[model samples]
Target: MGWLDRLLGRRRPRPIPPPLWQQTVARLPFLQWLPAADLARLQSLSEAFLAAKQFSGAAGLEVDDAMGVHIAAQGCLPILNLGLEWYDDWVEIIVYPDEFVVPRQEMDPDGVVHEYDEVAAGQAWDGGPLILSWQDSQMAGDGYNVVIHEFAHKLDMINGAPDGLPPLHPGMDREAWVAALDGAYDDFLARVERAEARGEEALEQLPIDPYGAEHPGEFFAVVSESFFEQPQVVAAEYPALYAQLALFYRQDPLARAQAAGSSRSR
Candidate 1:
């Protein structure tokens, strides 16, 4: 049994076949960018994650070994250095065939309630199961990763609420974390507003996702996706925030990407 199986008192998950693992890694460029040692570590972490969580498919979809392995690989990346125990609170992962509708109700300032349906590609519930659209989960390499985005929210919720702040490490500065993310959040919100005023053309040019402006929590999740999938954009656009994330996640994706690029050039 793996460490997670022993810790959780669950049966050990079957190991991912070597050919399948290679095929899945080949399809994800960000995973391809990982150093050999880190890639091996990620595989081990993914196995533990699979052993610990239950996966169910919704809307007539079927969850297969390949699908489970793919999701586990991406989902475990953030916790690679942090450890599997960070995700011990949650046990179920629900996946839809495509974007799913969630019924939402809200009360306005005048105490009137409004109800509507919101379509989402992925969602991470507080102390509950994580949900995803299989279609969106497949779109990982270009920075719009629903798996990473939702998993990042899970990390944020580990402490209390998902308010763009996860519990910092012993040496990490909470004040600095707030300053960096808040400053970038404000700036990005302004940029998004301007893009909305100008039109869709301007919005499409944004290096980061405009949905990040929705909330600080959302910003943290969106940037976390970029941090792993497109580290160059985060490192170049928000150096301070990127540094904070590196410190929090305990991995330097930018350094890895740069090393890979230099290797390719040589």
Candidate 2:
């Protein structure tokens, strides 16, 4: 920032120290596939995210700067193309030592209400804090990243309830996105039903995580995680939905990963 801007109290973001940043990126292999420009942008977004949000650790866990930076790096990856303003609705991130149980209540279509405790690795509440299990967050890079999953939920909830649909940019075909996602969702559900009839082992053969078939909102999150962590699997198994996600995210992870691999060979 210039002197004049400083005089006006327009504080600039502090640069993320190289050592801290290198440590964070070293642990996240998926980030290695990002192009230099995109990697730099993700770094900037992660710094901004760290500056804007508050982090708290639960169950006797202490959230140090390293842990915070690591979490922020993964959290900011989804918005690498999209801006940080999309996450302005929430400012707090709560991390648990392990899986946490949340009390949930729901009303059935028949007008009956039910209550239960849901075990979750991560969760995002509309207009509220985003929660995660640090244990699950560390298990990223195996085609499942809870940080990305919860952040995806936040994105899905930006317009309204997260029913698997997030607000699309101008010129994006809403009908096309719906058809692709809904069609895949229905097909996956049918497959799961058939697998149940066959055996549990059959259900384990699903391309995408079986949890995705739980609901539309989860389908979006699960696929979003797969798009970043296992793009090839997602692209191959659900090309149409992958294309829709590629359009929405404005990045192609499969292409990026291939390019990264080619560069490594050189």
lDDT of 2 at 198: 88
The top-ranked prediction according to lDDT is 1
Residue 217 lDDT (model 1): 96
Error (Å) of candidate 2 at residue 245 is 0.7
TM-score of 2: 0.92
Model 2 clash tally?
A: 0
Each model's lDDT: 0.91, 0.87
For model 2, the run of ten residues with the poorest summed lDDT: 2-11
Please give, for residues 1-266, the per-residue lDDT of candidate 2 as tens digits: 43212222323455677888888888999999998888888988887777778777888987777777788899888888889999999988888999999999999999999999999999899999999999899999988899999999999999999998999989899999999999989988898888889898988877778888899999999999999999999888889999999999988999999999999999
Candidate 1 C-alpha error for residue 146, in Å: 0.3
lDDT (C-alpha) at residue 33 in model 2: 97
